[model samples]
Target: MAQNSYRRPAALLAYEVSWEDLDGAETEVSPPKLVEQVDVPATDQLELMNALWDAVTFDAPWVPETSEPLRLVGHEGAKSTHYELVLVGPSVAGGSSPIMTDPRFAGEHDAWDDIALDKSVDLFLDQILVPLVEVYGLGNMAQLDAARLSKMRERVRLIYDKHLMGLGVYLKAGPTGYVQGMKFVLQEMVENSAYRLDMANMIRDALGESAQNKVSIDALEARLTARASATAILAVVQAVLVGTDVGKVMYDLSASWPEVAWSAVSAPALFALSPSEGVVTRDESSVKFTVLPKGATSGNYRYRWTTTGDYGLLSDLLLPDAKVLDTREREVWYFHNSPANIQDTDRDNVSVEVFEVPEGATSIPAGAKPIARMAALVRGDTRVIDPRLEVNSGATPADMYDSGETYPCVEMLLRFPRDPKAYGYVVSIVGMGGVGDPRNPNYHFRTGNGNVDYRMDNKIGVNVSDYRGTCAWYNGFFGGDPADWPATEPDEIMGSGGYDASNETMLLMLFSAVDYDDDEDLGAEADLWKEWARGATFEVFPLYPEDAR
Candidate 1:
């Protein structure tokens, strides 16, 4: 058959044969066999291939084809004949089957291998199986309605709020406060064993009447009996009373008591047994009570002390809880001395000194001389005076008295006071010489025409007169002319010398008294005779540590 033909021929057969008897009897013959030609359409051939492919694809444990021949048989007129059928075309021995090679059925033979079985199973579970199980299987066992679930959760919350929250509040009220309220209940319990019902009713009244049906009184009683005991209650009371004032507890307890016979009479009687003030160091303490009404004395009373005091004895009463020892040394000494003459006869004239007074001593150690003295002129004058002198002298003169001057100041590298308690110090120009009139002393005292200024560490500048008569310790100072000083109070200079606790030493510079005069009365010759005296003082302040406060 042509491979591309739309129709193919198939043979149908019927067979007949005449048999002769061995004894030469009459032989019987069948009717003539018939043959029919059938045209198997191409679609039928493809359908047959597809059927075979589906069997191989769907069946588990598929068997590979073997070379055994296959036959079809039919019986006719008591005789049976078999016809062998053979599949002919391109052999599928070492390559793909003819169905797979065909253009119409290409890739159809192995298409089953490309199927994603996992995805199909997942789709079944996600879309079909899961919803069916949830709707029917779980629905029969649980209420899955959103409204019913919400109501169930709300009921649980109501139970917690009505019962558990009230219990929490009652317990947090402390043994002293809540125990008094429960005293009547405990006394009732001791008198009668059937107290669980009463407790449930009491809880319902305290929490809400709606909870009467929800609370299981039997369960609550079982839990309470398992956890609570008289000995434990007494231990709690004893623990709270230790290091506590017993008299205060009695007074507080009395204030909450009713005006019944037990409270009015028995409570006061019990109070008489406890000492008005006493210490309780142990869990148990013996107390003596005298019954004057009955003319009897008893020593069986138990008392617990409850004050939060450092000293627990009657003799140590009224003492502070803790003593604050302010051991900081606040003793401050002011060391002042006058340097008789400070002058600049030559250029760059400067005098340096080391002024130190021992603690508790009034004066500097004897024979302590200036550390350095040189003929180096150093002076600071007002800007107005400095320019005028430069113009008149036809030469620019250095303003050595300014704190920034390095050459000609009386530089004192003073150490912080050795006292560990010392935190800060105050430097003051206590007194000055060459003030012609005490009543009208020139606030800006001058040698010739140069003004004197003091500086700390070549940074903080202040006029000597700012500290003249006042003992105020300021952490900052204003420089420049007095007219340029701030009308309002100047802002404080942070890290200035006054309260600086970090710096171990500070450089104090006192500028030289130099000749810068241009006035006729103050001659150039007056620079030789110009002299001044300054008396400065150092005072240290004490700092108390935080613990001492």
Candidate 2:
């Protein structure tokens, strides 16, 4: 099958606050802030002209319409007008980063024609551009020499074309979609380097030497910085919306798993070993589904190869051999060898059923260890299903030390080799169910009015001390006493109520830890679960990091 390519946005609308009427007076807007009646090529204008000339050929639609208006009017019949102006482009919605955020294109016009592709492209462009300009605003032009300035303009042009134009397509497509857009942006940067430099210098000169009260260069710097940060945030948000390639990689790997190589047999009858459910079968291949019963609440379950393959697939892409067994009843059992090409004597119709295995009998092979272990108990797999990071409202808990606003949590998954003697994987559950204090219930710990009294100073308690040259922050002795802590192990460090490892997953979440009252924190728990599911997908194989090997 041909790989899915990036989709473009249909309409890119740039909004320029043309003019605003405050009370009864009119005001003008300036560069980076223009105030005037904004204009598009105009649908009616374009259509009437096109129809007259039979020039309309493409399905390109006009940009979206807005009630906000090109010019803002004061209440009733205000004699004066104040305006903020903007320019938007059709491709801005789905175009590359620079085009998306290009100051020149104000996306205010409505679409004359409806093209679904155009809409997507518009959305893509809109999602990305607004932020880029906000964040990287034509940085310091004073330092640019003539040649370098020229180069910078070229760079800007390249950014406009590639990153901006390619907005509609997926970012993961890499150089394919946005690469060209990036090039365009660089071209724009090169073409307009001198202009942008002159503009910046003029603004600096004007603002820097302004009277004590006028907008100062310092103020502009602050404002520009804020804008840049906002732009960066928007870019990050759009990248996330475009979706990551990680899940796709997981699904593809799962489809090629070894289980498909083995003939599909009737679901085996599970025997109770140590009062645990255990089902056995004579089949093996790339991917294997061992449905361990998650107790009685979940009915006769099926842990088959998942179409999405979000979890419960072998880690190593390589094939493995052996009989298939179901562990529905949480029992353990030894693998029973089958005669080569043997058929069962019983003539009864074979049906797939829950395989429960007693825990003791199904001990993992001590001598022949697989690099990783994968499992998904239907009900027990609650961790796998609910609270997918993609759909969740809560991104991350709000940092309490700062304003009560929340930080977006980044999701990551990692797979590690299964250990026979020790628990190989550890998941840190934050917010709500795990770490949050229920009494206060602060999602990001923003105490409102009367809620102030219920607040706690800090969530986690820690003792800071120095050992030799290293500063050791101790939380607790989980699994053992504090004295038994593995001081030399760099991976293990103080976390939440105890020490935690620096495994790929752990490190990802740990770095995201922020201060918020448990009650205020919203997304950490979901983040933890989603991270685990992602980690599970990776664990489907015995794949190891390069350093580990």
Candidate 3:
């Protein structure tokens, strides 16, 4: 034919050789068999056969770079990428078919592109080959132990002695050579081997138990990573409101109320209706209440209280959870003026109103005590203080009618458009001078009492300056006339300098101009409070990141 082009070698087919028959005698005649030749297109047939033999016997592939093991074709002339093989069928004696199965082609073949030959070989050897070898070795050991238990025990003693030497507890046989001395060592060695087997069994059982428990551990991890509950959000609100140092409540729901559901009810609600609505009657040990307006169409109401108790005890109102209204920051307004007037200047005679009722009661009961009312009234007859007067537009001077003295007090009202999807908060603040009030512990030392003066860094109650930007600013008077106030702008003031978003109780800020002396006075100190009342403003808006939530 052509020049021997198959340079790579081909492996000898198992069918190429004859084996012993059932009689245990080697057969001399050639058997009827199918043989394959290597398909590598080598010009030399002998060289191709040699390469195939080496690949199978020594585990080296024909192409070392590609690392693909050679495969045999049925015929000598079968073509491959760079080789060809021949398929031949030689007749044996008595015309029998092939007897032995081919073990060479038993394992799975690798895919063309992603195969890493070395790694695949390593995996096959470790996962399959080593296990198979260990199984065969264990079988042989079992047979040996069955036949020679006494000898195996002796072997274990020897192994124990070797190990003992490594552990620095070896006992060598002395020249006296007492056989009794070695009996204890043999017993210890045998026990050690038994202990090893027990330990291995224990380890295997632990692994199996861990595998069984894996499902539960995975589920718990998933639950921990899921979205937090509504109770968590409520806790965040409490933390912002009532902790100690900064005074925002902090408690983990997992530890504090583990049994509570996410949507469970909070503390009970206490109510206080306008007084003119009805009258309250006394019940035995409990308060019975009712409301009566003066006229049906007049909208005027009056409340009569008959509950017999010390009014001071009513300070901690008791009512159920359902009675409280969901007003967001509007709740601040109800408590603002009801408890006590925060704007009073007199230190010693400061007065506050305390109420006592059921924990969840919605309306204020008649006959309930309203104790401790102190009035250091700021303007008195000099300036008229309209409590609920609404401010719509423009800079207008509120009339101050005290002893014929008239000073102008400017008021501002802000209204925000309602958002259906977003939660909103409104913050109101009054300005103060650089020196904080000596009486208040929450004072910040940095800012001045001006419309524009603001505080910077703030944390908790540690320093004076820090409190400026925190809660509602009601410390002292700001300095500015309405004309001095920015006319073109919304007259809104930034709280970062003193009043901050974190301490904002409510969204609305109500401002008033007050005369320092009984007469409508215009001294420089009076000007300061007057200016503050006239021109001061606060910012109000939503707090959290809407998109993120």
Candidate 4:
């Protein structure tokens, strides 16, 4: 919206101070002095002319029908002073006396008409213009920018229209009804004055430091509230008396007031995670977590883990004999025995048993060895182990065991330590040799052809929880016709496998260690084995709950 251009012909009103003698003769004490010059849009021309006439004809009561002028009575050494007003403007050729005959006046002249006109002018100056001038200079309404002034005027017009233009209720009720409607508008403005001022200051601050101190919030609020009430009351009264639109009058008047600036609201900051570390039970059905920067009281937040894929391996917790092996082809833990080879007939004859020993045990369980003695080989890719034992049975008679113990056997006992942190563990044993010699073709026994057999056994402790079922062990002999062997590939043949147990107290695997057949015929004598132990590898994972996303 554009700013109002208050351009029009200017009118000058001058007044002379005078005193009257007791005989009813008047004498001028001072020459006429300029009071004010007024200019307004063409729409307001008639109103301005009427006010000028009233100010100039204020002495009408003293002029009686008999054509005798009344004298001013003196009191306590002071004489009453009278003001004789003269208006010079385009509408008035000689003075304001001609205004009564102007067609714009549109009424029969009478003594009371002069009196009411005089009062209207007095109210306009004393109640409306004076208060506004005290806060802002005359014709300096530009202090309020065009857009802001337009908005303020729109608000005033809205209130006036809503309350006053109700099916002509105020028209039927007269001036009193219009006054009451204006009072409702004034009440709302007064109540919201403080809030509007605060909003204005916020806008000023956002504009930068220079605009912040342009006006004081408290002072501007007080002045504007008082001035608005006074101007609004006079505007309503004039509207009722002159049959003009109260909304337009208020809209026009608001353009001369200071602007209350405004701005848009900013967005909120990002939220933060509540707990630094998150932990959940292994194989738990659900996840629990918290996030913050909680907004309004009714607001809620969602959470999620940003990282993906399997949980990271706990490298530090890996056993001393175990080494993490990561390559383009595979990722696993390669466990090796201290002495890769154990030779002794007595060691081979006895069944191999593996067990986990507690930290403070006073005495070792009979025939039970420290779990560290049994090296563990764990595959990181599948996170499970497949143990297998292979034996060659078709070698010559001299190559076979003399005791007739056809199969080697091994036994293991696994126990969980206090407060175990891993989700589960895997243990596997792979062997491929037995008493046999393939070179003695004539002495071949039991279908000969150097037949090889495989088997596996696994057991879980009672304390274990959430046990995933075991996988089948591959079974077949290497010797018979290649087509007669197991349908699966030879190298893929494995023992009982793939069990997941949480909080496991103990586990056992039973098997016998036997010598490999002399297939190469190197003639190297088999060394005796006293105590035999191989490295055992394990893959452990800690459980974590899923994210809430």
TM value for model 2: 0.20
lDDT of 2 by residue, 124-238 (tens): 3332332223223433212212222223334444444543454444433432333333233323333454433433333333222222134344554444435434344444334
RMSD for each model, in Å, please? 52.9, 25.3, 39.4, 44.6
Which residue window of length 10 is worst by lDDT in model 2? 257-266
Worst 10 residues of 4 by lDDT: 343-352
Q: How far does residue 213 in candidate 4 sit from its true spot (Å)?
A: 6.2
What candidate 2 gets wrong by more than 4 Å, as runs, is 1-299, 305-525, 528-549
lDDT of 3 at 526: 31
Alpha carbon lDDT at 515, candidate 1: 18
The prediction achieving the highest TM-score against the true structure is 2
Error of 3 at 459 (Å): 14
Comparing 1 and 4 on TM-score, the stronger one: 1
lDDT of 4 at 214: 65
lDDT, each prediction: 0.25, 0.27, 0.24, 0.26
Q: Report the lDDT tens digits of candidate 4 across residue range 1-549.
A: 011122111122223245455554666544332332222111232222222212222122211111111121222222333433222211101223544444422332342243333322322322232223222211121122222322443343343344323423322232354354444433544566543454334323322233335656666556546645566545544544344333334343334211111111111212222111121112111111122222222222111122211232211122232122111110121111212121110010001112334544433455553221111111111111222211111111121334422221111222233224434334432231222434221121113332322121223222121122111112223344322322221112222222234443323222212223212211111100001112223322233223212
Candidate 3 Cα lDDT to native: 0.24
Superpose all Cα atoms of candidate 3 onto the true structure and report the RMSD in Å to 1 decimal.
39.4
Error of 2 at 180 (Å): 15
CA deviation > 4 Å runs, candidate 4 = 1-142, 147-151, 155-172, 192-213, 224-549
